[model samples]
Target: MLRRVREGLHRWPAVARLVAIAALLLVAAAAHLAARSEPAGRWLPLLVVAVVGALVAGAPRHRWPLPAIWLVATVLAVTRGSAVDPGATAAALGVGAVALVAALTADVVPVLRTRHRRGER
Candidate 1:
């Protein structure tokens, strides 16, 4: 089941990229909404979103940027609020983790497929 899904994603790079972008946007939006009361919180998520968007749009061939972006976004989202609510933090982290996994899977699927094609597995 998992292999099928992975293969499907690898078969459709554009769809996988879209899915990852959507997930990242959702995480960024959630973070923004959660901390909208603060001035810094308002712009920070936007900045992160722009950066992530640019990286995704500009370097579709690169895989390292997504993980790095995920790390930075997670840290910023989790630590932005003055008083960190455990529940909210946990939720954000969970969603961010999902986004990370999705991004990594999308990035790795092609490489794995190539290796398999070459009988390198």
Candidate 2:
């Protein structure tokens, strides 16, 4: 069973990446909601940061960064933003900005590497 799951992930890495990101987003959303009325709610934004960071770190090498960024941004906006109340708006925006910056970095790093390689030739 474990071997089959690993093989499936290897065969469809992009799908696996999307699913992983989606799962993280869901966890973040749930954390945001659960902590909303608690004293620990202030710390929930960190969870958002962690989720976006994980997504960026695990971004697929061969896929465009836009889809993952878009999914995270949209999910954060809907789940962490005003849908819950004004309280979550700040966390949503902050996390969204982080995700955007990470996306830019993901796109830029490969291009820079390719350019450097060509220059060496």
Candidate 3:
């Protein structure tokens, strides 16, 4: 059973990353709503995003920066979501989610397919 799961993930890496993002996004979105409900807490998520963005991007060795970028944008969505109605908010979030996945795919797939060719005899 576990082997099958591993093989499936290996064959479809995007699905694995997507499941992770979906799980985290649910929590972050809920956090957004909770923070909104409390006037004093509204800025906390945004502030956290800024701090983390600085920390992550500041380091050159953070090889995979896509997740960090997605996280910041997702948090930003919560901050700016107030101006729009619920339906529009959901659609916008959906678009952002797609963008996040697309960005990751664009950054990763080509590199994975490329061969170093340097060491090949």
Root-mean-square deviation of every model: 9.7, 6.5, 11.4
User: How would you encode candidate 3's per-residue C-alpha lDDT over 1-121 as one tens digit per residue?
Assistant: 6456545655775765554445345435534443334342553464355334333323212323433444555456567856434554464456446756776677676666665443463
The TM-score, computed over Cα atoms with residue i paired to residue i, of candidate 3 is 0.33
In terms of lDDT, the best-performing candidate is: 1
- The residue pairs found clashing in candidate 2 are none
Q: What TM-score does candidate 1 reach? A: 0.48
Residue pairs that clash (backbone atoms under 3 angstroms), model 1: none
**108 Cα displacement, candidate 1 (Å):** 0.7
* Of candidates 3 and 1, the better by TM-score: 1
> Which sequence of candidate numbers ranks them by TM-score, best first?
1, 2, 3
Q: What is candidate 2's lDDT per residue for 41-117, written digit by digit as tens? A: 55456455545544544444433343344445545545644544445545544555676677668778989999999
Error of 2 at 2 (Å): 9.6
Clash totals, every prediction: 0, 0, 0
Q: What is the lDDT of residue 93 in candidate 1?
A: 59
In model 1, the worst 10-residue window by lDDT is 30-39
List where candidate 1 sits over 4 angstroms from the true fold. Answer: 1-52, 55-57, 76-81
Q: How many backbone clashes does candidate 3 have?
A: 0
Give the Å shift of residue 19 in candidate 2. 3.1
Which 10 consecutive positions of candidate 2 have the poorest summed lDDT? 62-71
